[model samples]
Target: YKLIIHTDTLIGLSFSGVHTWLEMYGCEWDDQTGAADAFDQFGYDGEDFVSLDLKELRWISPVQQGIPTVQKWNNDRAYLESDKNYFSTECIEWLQKYVQYGKSSLKKTVSPQVSLLQKSSSSPVTCHATGFYPSGVTISWQKNGQEHHEDVDLGELLPNEDGTFQKTSTITVTLDEWKKNKFSCVVEHQGKTKTENEIRTNPEGSVPIGIIVGALAAVVLLVIIGVAGYMVYQKKKGFKPVSGSDDGSNSSAHTVPQA
Candidate 1:
């Protein structure tokens, strides 16, 4: 969100005044369902003065002081039609273009690393899941093999510096509750990677309770480093290594070229 600020004025011999107004308008686009929503609103003296209802193509005013302006603006059918058309079609197309341009990063899914943390034996246990993408995940606690919700406190989903997301869920249990029943934190996420220990038994796309994605990241890092190292060597020094995937797509991973 940003502040809406601008100035407009028509200087003529009949009138001389500054036309500074505070107003805001924007649109939201959903790529999954291809739906677009728009809003055009205005404020006056730090109050909700008027807004445009796109569906009705009419202006709405909360305060009585805005009634005259609303009634006058609502009567302009041509202006309303043009406003609706621009926001629904043109604005949405521009936003979709930007989304398409950033599809690789925006749509990429990175698996999370789940860990149970506690400051002391008596402290509440926090189930932390971090370094994930898309920000949609589930974290729950289980007691005696069943779902538990009584003492659970879910944390806010936060962004990481590398464009990933992290979340935490804490469960408070006493010594008696711990000794008598089995307590476990369950985290659910998609796009899980296969691991060596559980590869043979688990079926393809099986969602384990939790798995560290760093092993997979390490392997990818090594592959990228190898490719970058090969490119660093000039053709005169050695053979230039060609890196290509099965679909013939080359990764953008790179390092500083050798001097």
Candidate 2:
């Protein structure tokens, strides 16, 4: 058996077109076997305060165990028939109508797009799943079909701009393990079937995209150098050599001085 209770109060004031939000508080309790296993209260009355730590179940803030101030502010008996009311009775009615409309009109299910990516060859790999609805998801890493918890960093589900949700999980691996072992990212969503994304391992001595580009550049540079050297050699070989004397006999030119 389970029992849960939630209380929320919002205090807002508007003048003409401008509005001011003054105070807000939310409280939750679970009357677990009459012991109240989950009793916590948090709010901001011009200053943030919490009655008890939700996890530790102990007082951590200056505020002690007491009913939230918002409750007293909203109590019907606190307001007089002649006095101006702080809360808008019309707004409360509209809020209830909106809740009913959301329950029946909202689109609730959306499939997620799961992807596996790495920042670099040596960096940790991230498994990102995004564009899902309802925000209930489980992301984990598995090696050889066995789930791994150590070295895995799990992130919380965050809402997207388009009313969807996204989450990411990361795992560190040695370069040897990254290349030799098979690792997969498993994503489980409440609305969609389970999904898996396997890591693509590079073969031994295989060049990456960046390394391949560098090799091509090196080859181009070598080709340019070879072409330049060959041009220089051709120019040297094309030079006309001094021919032997026209008489075909080896001779030297001698100039005589006249008296």
**TM-score of model 2 vs. true structure:** 0.41
Q: What is the lDDT of candidate 2?
A: 0.52
Model 2 alpha-carbon drift over 4 Å, by segment? 1-96, 104-107, 199-259
Question: Once all C-alphas are superposed, what RMSD does model 1 give against the true structure?
Answer: 17.2
Per-residue lDDT of model 1, residues 37-131, tens digit only = 87777766556778889888888999998898888887777778777776676556556655666876777888877777655556666777888
C-alpha RMSD for every candidate: 17.2, 35.8
What overall lDDT, based on C-alpha atoms, would model 1 receive against the true structure?
0.62
Q: Number of the top candidate by lDDT?
A: 1
What is the C-alpha lDDT profile of model 2 across 1-259, one tens digit per residue?
A: 1211223444655565433222222222222342222333444554445443434323344554333443343343323221121112222232344455676646577878887766557877778787787788888788878878879998666656565677788899987986787788888887456556565445444433433443455566678789987876555222111123234243221111110
Candidate 2 weakest ten by summed lDDT: 250-259
